[model samples]
Target: MATVGDQLLNPESGWQRIDDANKNIIYNGNWISATGDPNTYAGTAHYFTLSGATTNSIEFYFYGTKLRIIDMYWSNRVNNVTVELDGVISSYNPNNSTNKYRVIVFERLNLQYGFHKVKLTTTSTSNNFSLDAIDIDSNGEITAPPLSKFLISSEDKHYSITNEYKDNAIPAMTSNTSPNGIVDASSFYTTFYPWKAFDRIIDPNGWVTNINVLTGWLSYEFDSPKTISAYSVQAGTTPVGRSPKNWTFEGWNGVSWIVLDNKSNQSAFAGSEYRLYTFDNKVAYKKYRINVTANQGAGDFLAIGDLGMYELDKYISSVDTSEVSFIKHGMDKGMVIDLEDEFIERRSVVKENSPLGLGKVFKQKIDTVKTPIKKASIT
Candidate 1:
């Protein structure tokens, strides 16, 4: 039996360890383990403590005739391998989702007999609340699957020109993904599957698929950035009947919301009906979630037709804030930031090295695709 973290056994849970000593303080998601040394939840994205998955995520299952649910979308997600009741991959979703990503729900998702993998190709600058482990509910207890064998499989270098309107790379799958076109370039104006958008010829967003509701604030998660003068958003139609609102003129000020002068809270369409919406300037974000506060619909009926973001970052000023994150962890004993200008000129990236221990935790790889950053190799 795998022992869970002390923090997860909060006062709310039914099960608790009677003999284990509560020795560590769980603040900012880290503290000393029974081992005594400070332990950070610095395992893989979405994955919890390196020892196991319970602390950081939920598990759903039962043997023979059992069901399971997997909670998801933390950071730098590589893959989602839904196992069949017999243990083969029934479906998959990979290195996707936006930065403010929360959870990805899989339903009636039957699984089979074997372990699975969620290999990530990209990484995020931070991690979020993973999970307390999977929840299982069955008349008879089901055995958990074996530890999944996973590895970061490299892919062939694929090349492709930028899209007609954007500079996004629609590279073909080397090994990690499938379909050069499906995963590559797309738009209502262009391509289609494995190499396409979530909803292509399938009538824009998969209104016929899983989603069923939309609430609270509305959001749109894009794969790339965009450049524009102004954006226009519309909800339901002229009257708020069975949909959201058809009001436009809402705006964003680089960071958060910039309340515009236009105000049209049309609840006529807020009663109960499906609606389609669009934007004129096409404002963008990686993920767009509209928090529903009422029973507008039993569940989320968001008929998402697209995903996009601002064309350009335009936030390049000076004094990268990331330099601040490094300051908190403690830097090289004699290293000084005053000479940062002479060290890296064009582009520099640092990766974690000692993923398990505290000794040294970084290595780096840089590419001068655009700017030329200088680098140094310590003797």
Candidate 2:
């Protein structure tokens, strides 16, 4: 009895065994049995040999998301084999000086779920073709997500203005004097380093100083829904008094904000560095916000230099084009008319034209024209 190592067939440790004698496998033409010692051939019972027949082939009908072909490789007698997976032919040549058995001849991963077929044909009569077994993953394959392109930052910076931050103190000298007190959060959106105290480098040149309010918030809206799992925040220049000490991360669920992750009594770091937070589960959302409830030193304002979010995957959905209008030039007004006289002239038939013959003639005329034409153009 053959056993699987991890029961999971992945790119790293490919497993799930199908021996040559499996019921789902079919061998055509004459094949010779070449059984080896258990110690020499990875505890495999038997192997089939093919030679001197171009029609000789082996077919496998399998239910798996991925398939891998295993065979023996030897320089002296091993021959080239034609591998076909789901009707696609892939040629493989095995030539090596050392006799290595149980080699992966070919593999296809991330295929559509359901049953698929694989065929291997012997192409050389002089060389020997050995059939070992096939590796398949019945658990199905995982599709990797597309790469993300959005970046979070303040306004006027590269790929900025796409994110929004609010309810924070505007850094001094960088605020616009609106009807309300100087907007303290302006410096948070600038393209400056050390935007917050927790930044890797403690630079006080630019920061978003919160108002005398204890609880502040920063929020960002992405252009599209993204699967995010981690985020980071740079504290303000004054780590003790203004840096956020306790905060909660929330994501918009189309109706209300839901807490994704939260941390309580988070101590302030001494220097400027981003404090990273990761969620155990991923959330797909377009909006994310961080609510800071307390600061390190009982300060009136809570300052943050920069905020960042990392996306885990992209949302995959199908688009419906049935309602879309696709207009082809010269295809709207073409009319097909069946002229009994024209059909008689073309086929030289004198019988009275029936409605079916007229309809056939009309279809023929339309097919011949290929493009729409004005009714006046028809003779």
Candidate 3:
């Protein structure tokens, strides 16, 4: 959308003007540096970020009066940074004055797509931290006039589609029918998009394999609480590798698991750990999922996990709108920033261009702020 006041007044080509006053990407930039400098906390400021190129979202606004949201920090990729705002994206600390003017907003931090380097650090050492403008909103990923043609699908083990399809996208893969795997509501897959919902009737003993899986089924039904108090199966393990991940709400409520979580065995490879599920509350079974596909056998760490149902008052609607968060940003399509809306703005002032009529050519100028005749008790 690229227009939030021209991306908050366009500045951050990758922002790295760390005028080191001593340990101050955080709090000391409040005052102090005219010449009596003293803000050094290992000063090695940074910048340079191609990394996932911004569709992950970043917003900006800064005024600076008392400015002290715990000094400052939107820091990136290391430990990431989220002082415990609990929205879960990364790196945010609003515990001082809540940064009224020194406005600092944070957003989803799903990196690891391409080049990586992002920096806005500070321990706040006081160089009089002055930065009033900065904006970088990227969905960046379309390089050149390259791909004229690139076909795929095979004839060996499973798939073989060929003609990779793309002529403005055949009205979303079909004009009157086939949506490929389905995603209606006019958002015709809006470039392959789908909200989380899959049901295999709650992974019986566990299963996934429908020839690599495109997608299907998603059901819901509940009501057995007049006699059942607990049952669990809260799986949400995106563990990270690829393909739909998030759904770790394991089951079993005869005793433990007010929520019970498990990453589900996602092939297990790199740093693999949490994958578990033991809480079988005698199997109350209703419905649940998270088997994106692929189980021909043997290790599979590509990653994916979803399937949750915790009933009470519907148990907060079964806590899991499918926590799906993503943004490829290249093939097009995006706009999602809601972890308390970590600063995302769009729109650029383009509505004042309607005055061109020698003889009423496409006209629409009526209201002149004239609404006065309300003569009921006025006489």
Q: RMSD in angstroms, all models?
A: 22.0, 20.6, 23.3
Judged by lDDT relative to the true structure, which candidate is superior, 1 or 3?
A: 1
Instruction: Sort every candidate by TM-score, greatest first.
Output: 2, 3, 1
Q: Candidate 3 at residue 297, lDDT?
A: 30
Cα lDDT tens digits for candidate 1, 194-233: 1222222223332211233343333333344433322222
Compared with the true structure, what per-residue lDDT tens digits does model 3 show for residues 177-263?
233233222111222222222221222111222333433322222323211222222222332233323333422244543334333
| Candidate 2, lDDT over the whole model | 0.50
- For residues 1-379, could you state the per-residue lDDT of candidate 2 as single tens digits? 1222212122233246666656557667666655664532344433344434568777766655667676655675445778888788887766566566666666665454444667787667666766666777634321222111121112332111111122222222222332222222322434532223223344542344434565666665555676566676765444445767788888889999899998876544434445556564345787677787776664455666666667533221222111121110111121222221111111112233222211111222243267654322222
Model 2, residue 232: distance off in Å is: 24
Q: Which residue window of length 10 is worst by lDDT in model 2?
A: 323-332
Error of 1 at 223 (Å): 61
At residue 376, give the lDDT of candidate 2.
27
Between candidates 2 and 3, which one is better according to TM-score? 2
Q: After superposition, how far is residue 310 of candidate 1 from its true place, in Å?
A: 56
Pick by TM-score: which candidate is best? 2
Clashes of each: 67, 18, 44
Worst 10 residues of 3 by lDDT: 314-323
**Candidate 1, superposed: residue stretches over 4 Å from native:** 1-61, 64-66, 80-84, 99-104, 109-132, 138-379
